[model samples]
Target: MNKQETHHHKGIEIFGKKTELYFAVLCGLFLVIGFLIATFTALPFWFSLSCYLISYFFGGYFISIEAFQKIIKGGFDIDFLMIAAAAGAAYIGSWAEGALLLFLFSLGHALEHYAMNRAKKSIKALGELSPKIALLKKDGKLTEIPITNLKINDIIAVKPNTKIAADGVIIKGSSSLNQAPITGESMPVDKTYIEDIDNLPAFNDIDKKHIVYTGTINGDSSLDVLVLKLSKDSTVSRLIKMVSEIETQKSPTQRITKKFEKYYVPIVIVSVFLLCFTYLIIDENFEQSIYRAITVLVAASPCALAISTPSAVLSGIARAAQKGVLIKGGKALESLGEITTIAFDKTGTLTEGKPKLTNVIPLHNFDEKELVQLILEIESLSNHPLAKAIVKDIKSQYKILVTNKASNVNAIQGKGIEATYQQEKVFIGNIKLMESAEILVDEVTISKMKALLEKGHTVMLIGLKNKIIGLISVMDLPRKMAADTLKRLKEIGIKRMIMLTGDHQNVGDAIAKQIGLTEAKGNLLPEDKVNAIKVLLKRDGKIAMVGDGVNDAPAMALSTVSIAMGAAGSDVALEAADVALMSDKIENLPFVIGLSRASKTIIKQNIFISLAVVFLLVPATIFGLTNIGLAVAFHEGSTIVVVLNALRLLRFKTK
Candidate 1:
């Protein structure tokens, strides 16, 4: 089948399995038929009884069988209590009332199941993003093949508007790509071979412009990509895998409910026995006492309590995922609500991570245009972040064609470039590189470089023939939303916000001031970042560390919570982070925190509602204030109310 057809079939398969709703409707139909036959029609007693029996079995059969199995295993649960209550009603000659209890109980189960499945639709929709087939390039020809057959290093062709079938790097062509499926970014990212290939500093570095991922739509231009990862290991595939595993990692509240179940069932059974004995001694009537005991069992079943946490957590997760925030599990969601402090990595977290040319200072009577042209020519040959920024700026502002560009260009590690431009030897690097070359930089120029550095600009010294000519300053500007996001976080009770960076202390402090951060620790090595996170952990409340996810992995792992920003394109970031922000926008941070706090509130409310119902109803049943029918109505009513309350999270708006 074609990809569209396959997706259609999968959707149909999921909707076809909604058996609980159908079964509940069927049971309700039989109960109505039985009541009408007994009350209105002149039907025989056997016929009416058979209709009631059908309704009872249709609604109560699975419940009774589950209860029986638990009893066989020397266990009792809410199901067993429900079965006992229904059986007691039947014993008291209230067959219609027994059928009603079973019907309502089954209806509650079906509604809860339907609501939870509805919340899971967002995760299930992820499966539809990946295409089933790929356009494989073999021996310079394109052939259609299943995506599953594609392997690492395989070349693939993605046409305009078609979905990319694997994670790969661009070998040829350029296009604007819609990466919303993978990254949740609302904007279409521009990609081109010229910029990526020319400015790439290292082969292993992630060229955001050149890399395309599975499930993302290619723009109006075609692209030839070298597959770096197979279909199974692609970003979208791992996202689906992670979302599928969320249910297995239960929240603390869920674990407590499970433990509470172990003793709760037995306690209810004992309470039933004690109530029956005490009532019989007081009333001296066996039938009335037994009925009251059954009412107490139904009233204290803990159905709403059992569903309270999972329902709220599941809804919260679904809502967050819809907004491009992938919370791994309920534990992470709950932990987010408790985070008191947040730490951010400078580059890629608070800043855009894309440096731009801010200033170009020429020295020694050097022509500014000539120096810019020479720097551009040299930088165009390299792919470092700073080089890319300089080349981009020079190209946009000046028309410099390096037709016969520099030759024997060598990239000096941790410094800059060495090349022979126009037959004159030239060097471009930092002060360290200048010192190594024995170039004389006047104290005036040195002060200028220091002044630029203090303003958070990275300075690159340009030298020609062993003489310092000029210097270019580049800086990665802070993201526009960084300050606003920090303000929102503080408004919501975050105690401290700190920035950690590998840049110099002056640069870090300057950027921190721009972004409203109170403290910043700069010149931090990877290990130093980890030590900072450890020390922060020893202080007051939970700390969350946010970063690009690659270099910050160690420190993030040490923090209470790890968040990865712009994780759609980086597999390393996704793997290292506990929570992945699919897009680059920092504003989503406050939304996630708010959703978590709201979920916690709903969980507490649901638990209180459930427990209060039991506490109030159990005493009423004991004191002859409630009967079997009223107890069943109130008990099932609470379950429905709690489920509906949890469902409110599905409509939660982050904005």
Candidate 2:
């Protein structure tokens, strides 16, 4: 069974496991017994009515009291409307009709309340997925404690196959980390024992020996991590803050709807009073027109209209959350559905941010294995991402030994690293470093490097004695879900998807083509992306920009909607984004788009149905066709119908 049905069943179970059903049967039995006593035993009409009244009170006392309370609060809403209509029917001497209206309205309300509560419960489910406790280490011993109790500089141990309790650095041990829950990037990053000091200079490098963030999962090894931040200090905490902020932004349509309802209800009531008095003045048999006044009031209540839009929006949010997509609120969901085009940042959005060795070019007649060994020996001392990849590549290929006394090893900011290996100058960096060393790259070798760079590969040159010996080309790959998701977007009527990157045009085009992107631009800075989006907006197209690079922030802010890839810990990009992906799975983009569209469709249907009820009911009542029992039925029916329509969002699925 679905969540609503399940929740309804539990509520029914709590009230004697079948209390409503049993009570309904008991009321039916009492009606039959009272009818027999009145007809066959010659009982008084008042005594028979008393028996039926007892049945109604036992079954519907709560609804009657609630309706009365709502009336005193000056909010004569659906409950009060139902009670008034039913009492009016009784005043006209139709007791059975009034009692039946009360029973049906109560049952309809019970079902509607269950549906709405279930949907709200589903939306709040994501906040519960994170673990509450973390194992903190004090005085070399592990202590289990609540995540909220974590403080800065507190060291904690996290094991493989468990969620990281807070945001901090990895102090000890080597393992891969799943960062999808925070950054929306879908990949595992290899982390090592020694902290990369240059990458985290703001915090004391001494304390950042091992750190792990909240919401990431520990990979195949256990490690000790010092909690740098807890709860509100963590990335998830910031995401919650952003989401709450987005929810606070009022939607223009929702505002107008509220204002319309505020004046609409009172005016409708006043008009009904005028209609009743005018009818009484025109005819001497004006008591017959009382039904007309009750009918007009029943038709005019805006309960269905008021509940129509928000109920669907809230239900859609709940549905999106069920699929692991946390859309902040109605405004975000509405904006996301309206996007016409999408712009994507290459690194960490379209392509994997991590660079890997794709090709190795050997110079002269040197042995490839010997050149690789020399490169690994020189690179093993550095902890740059490129350096680590080179070391990993060397370790995977062959076992090699390097002198422990290698000296004068210093890293050049944004250039490369240099070291003296075997008392000879060893240089490894990009093509710029090769020129600075006065190393003349031959035409043939230069042509090969350019070809790789054209294909979006970053080239690292290995030089000795100011002569180029070999080059290692590292290229970023497309994510696993990129192509399939783009195809789905195309299927769903998204006209175009573009990849914007700072890499060479060839590289951007290569990955874009691989991921089904028809439009691709390369070597564009953050400003270029912003201008591109602005130009697109000038043509009246709504755009969604997705990125995980710090440079992509301005463009993200400029787009119609910003989606940030956070799995790689792109905090700056995420902070600038309108929507944060808790999972790196690109497939959710299409899933969420489908969800928004589905919700809009449901909301539109609800509006039409609600308005149709008012139009149909009011006309029928004017012609004296709608009775008190039928009026209450239609009133409660529209409320329940709109509610059910809104709750359909909870069952929404991507596939």
Candidate 3:
């Protein structure tokens, strides 16, 4: 569809969803007029009857259609029970009471649906959130063009306080951004122009300090952002698709409630049928017996219980999406709340995923500057993370020309890279690579490397032919927010937080200590990580694995709940994850877990409220303690309370 047509269709769809609320209001208005006329006005009896008839027509229209649809499909639901009860009331000459029952029932539906709309506000608003037009900056001039016309590498000029036009990196200016519309980040994140794009992560869309997302507002600086994604693939578009599927994926509680409704509705209908005739034996007054039977049906119907879990789950999913968390489904969210242990992949989950060169020691008459120059020429051809770090370190310290003289460079998995530079073989790797090549390192340099290794630095050997020339050490530090996030997780009752890494044992332990993880296991390959997860599974009630790369995908798949950093994780990690933190910030992890727990609590409370009302009213209704009108009032009132309670998730916040 064209953009205008798509908007027209959305408008109609939204308007159609509100029809139930409109009809319910009309039903209530007519019901009130009928009651006032019958109780106080000295009007003709038919006048009140007419108002009651109109109320019945307005209230019963939607219910009758739904009830008949179920019956036609050889099934039954709460709608069928409610329609039957209303008909039974009218059959016994209580037209006003029948109209009251349908009125309140429809009103409850309207209000429950309204609660659902409040939950869906995030998705509906997302469709219109991103700007349709962008100020395209091309060849030193700005032209306003439709976003659909934008392409990759296109630069869009964003003025101060304007919504970002596309997902891109700042190339020319610095600014702070209000990412609340996308990331739920309350503070403005600073963005600086990126000068070295090649240093970015190889296999993922890992967000950089200069990365800008669609729909976020730019602060008080004009920025030229180089577009990275098309309009259809923006963050806002992904959220729309994610949140739209919320209702289709049922939670465990919602699924169970549906099963209960299926059998419960049929049983109530049968019991009400038997009770009407059974009462004939005690009291020949058929009027009183039938009245009691209809009341029992209305009271026993699972109105509030039918909607209890779904409403809560929907609200929970919508609110989570608003806060930059995309829970795959209600089942995932419900299970994540119960996780007793969490496994963090050390590289990206706890650490910043970037290693920095900390020490450079030249040995055996090797010049340090020439060593750096040779290292840069050799490392520049490789995409290994360590190689990138080395190149980044060299460029940051000294300017150099890209001679591209290094040739035939190849990475040796688990060790490092080997190449031909200046017509001589240069080997840049760990001790394993040098030892296998029969290269000799002096005792003094070996002791220095050991000292660096003991201090959690990754030691690499620089060898020229059979002699070790020098060694450089690098370290990947834990994220700035990792310690604080772990503290919050502990306060919220996470019993165990372990780190699984592919680094050396000492390196993992040192990083784990900084992040406060309960345990640190290192020297793990992908399969070894899976085995560790298997071990964790046997000991914990439930476990969650947090990862952000292809290596972590296997372990993540084995966990009870898999969480991936959506913006930073490899595609495999995203596919395997049950939940995704789109913001790529570890700080948001606790919020999602806390939200899941709160949702579960709300679902339980709603189920209890719904059941308690039914249990209390059913006996009272049968014994003559309450009439049809009173039973209907309390029954529908609980449904409204249940829905309103679920809506509380929309405003859920951490202390």
Candidate 4:
């Protein structure tokens, strides 16, 4: 279809959704006119009858359509029961009563559709965030191209105050990017471009991986971003697909209630037929018997029960997404609320995952400045985490440049590294390297190394041949929010919080103490972490494992709930985890758990309200206490209340 024709079709679809409400309102208007003519005006009987007939036509429009469609498929629902009851009432000349019944039922349906569509908008809006057209830069010329036409390594110009069209790194220019849509981060992250073309500043790995995600806003300064991912493979696109699938996953209560409804609908129809037969034997008045039966059938149709759980489940999932938490399904969300033990991985989950140069002590005639220069020169050739820390730290501290850097360096598998500096042999590693190389270390220096280890520092020795020259300490600091987040988890009802890591036991103990964890166990391999979870599972009620790498994936899979730090998470870990904290903020953990608990409470309340209405109306209709109009009003009212209760989750906020 052409653009104008497509718009016309879209307009029709939008109006069709609102037509049910309009027809119901018109039905109520005619019902009032018919009632006034009979009770307050001296009008002809046919005039009132004509008004009621039009009211029924308008009220039954959607209901009749739905009932026939279901019948053609050899199935039935509340719509079928409603249409039969209303037609029977009108057949008995109770035109006003039947018209009122359809009006309320149709209005109930219109309201339900409105509420659900509003809830779905939370996730649907994610697809609209990226710009359809990107300003592509090719051969020094700017061209406007569709985002789908963009290719990997293609450069795009993102202007100030506009959303990025693709995921990329900055090759030229710089800006602060607001990544809230993708990461849920509160502050704007500053990004800079490094144009050494590709080979400069190899030691600073952070800049090499500096990236901007699609749908994030650029600040005042414009940026020239080198595209790293195609539009369809962008992070925002993946999130949209994940959330859309999450909406289809059923909760435990939803499964049970839905299964009950499947068999319940047919049983209700048969039971209504049996009740009418029994009533005819008791009373010779056929009109009253059938009237009572129709009222009871309308009352027990289970409209509210059919919708209570799914509505809450969908709304709960959408609410979590709003806060940047992608819960895979209602099952994971509910399981997180029941957790008693939470095991955290040290790297990237609890700590910063980046080591820092903490201390440097010189010995045997070497000054601190000369020792730092040697360390920087030798580590610049390596890409290890500790080496990067040393290089970064040295560059920030001194401006010394050696005319001849280290040469012929080779790493010893489980020990240290060996190289030639200024025509003399040099070494860097743990004390084992010293023992293997026959280097001498006095008792006083050995005691100092033990003290640094006790303080959670990884101690390394630097020396020339058989003489120790210095002791350097490297440590990975805990995140600033870790202490507060752990304290809050304790205040909330979690019984045990543990730390599991591949670092030494002393390092784990030190970090655990600073973060207020109940216990810390270190030196765990991938399979060992899985075994730890297996042990925790046999003792604890429910447990969660939080991590950000593939090493943590095995243990996460073995836990009651697996949570991944999405911002830095490996693809395997993100897929294996049941929940993704997209912002990598552990503070949101308590909020999501609280949301699940609240969702559970709402689900129970809805079930009770729906079942209570049925129990009340079925018994009352069996006697002479109610009519079709009153029963319809009570039944439809319960459905409206149940839906509105579920919609409350959309506005739920973290405390």
Count the clashes in each prediction: 3, 20, 0, 0
Q: Can you give the TM-score per candidate against the true fold?
A: 0.65, 0.61, 0.61, 0.62
Clashing pairs in 4: none
lDDT of each: 0.73, 0.66, 0.77, 0.74
- Candidate 1's C-alpha runs over 4 A off are 1-255, 276-280, 383-385, 397-400, 501-507, 522-534, 550-561, 566-569, 572-578, 647-655
Deviating ranges (above 4 Å) for candidate 3? 1-259, 282-284, 354-358, 363-370, 381-385, 397-427, 432-439, 450-458, 464-469, 474-477, 500-510, 521-535, 549-558, 570-576
Alpha-carbon deviation at 326 in model 1, angstroms: 3.4
After TM-score superposition, the amount by which residue 31's alpha carbon in candidate 2 deviates from its true location, in angstroms, is: 22
- Ordered from best to worst TM-score, the candidate numbers read 1, 4, 3, 2
Better of 2 and 4 by TM-score: 4
For residues 523-574, what per-residue lDDT tens digits would candidate 2 score against the true structure?
A: 6644466678788777756788888755565566667677876575365565
User: Candidate 3's residue-wise lDDT over 81-163, tens digit each?
Assistant: 76787777677666766776677677655544443332244345556768989999988899999998999889899998899
Model 3 per-residue lDDT at 521: 89
Candidate 2 ranges beyond 4 A from true positions:
1-250, 255-259, 282-291, 396-406, 501-507, 521-531, 548-580, 646-648
Tens digit per residue, CA lDDT, model 1, 503-600: 66887898888889979998674557778987898985578888773446556656767788864324544555668888667899999988888888
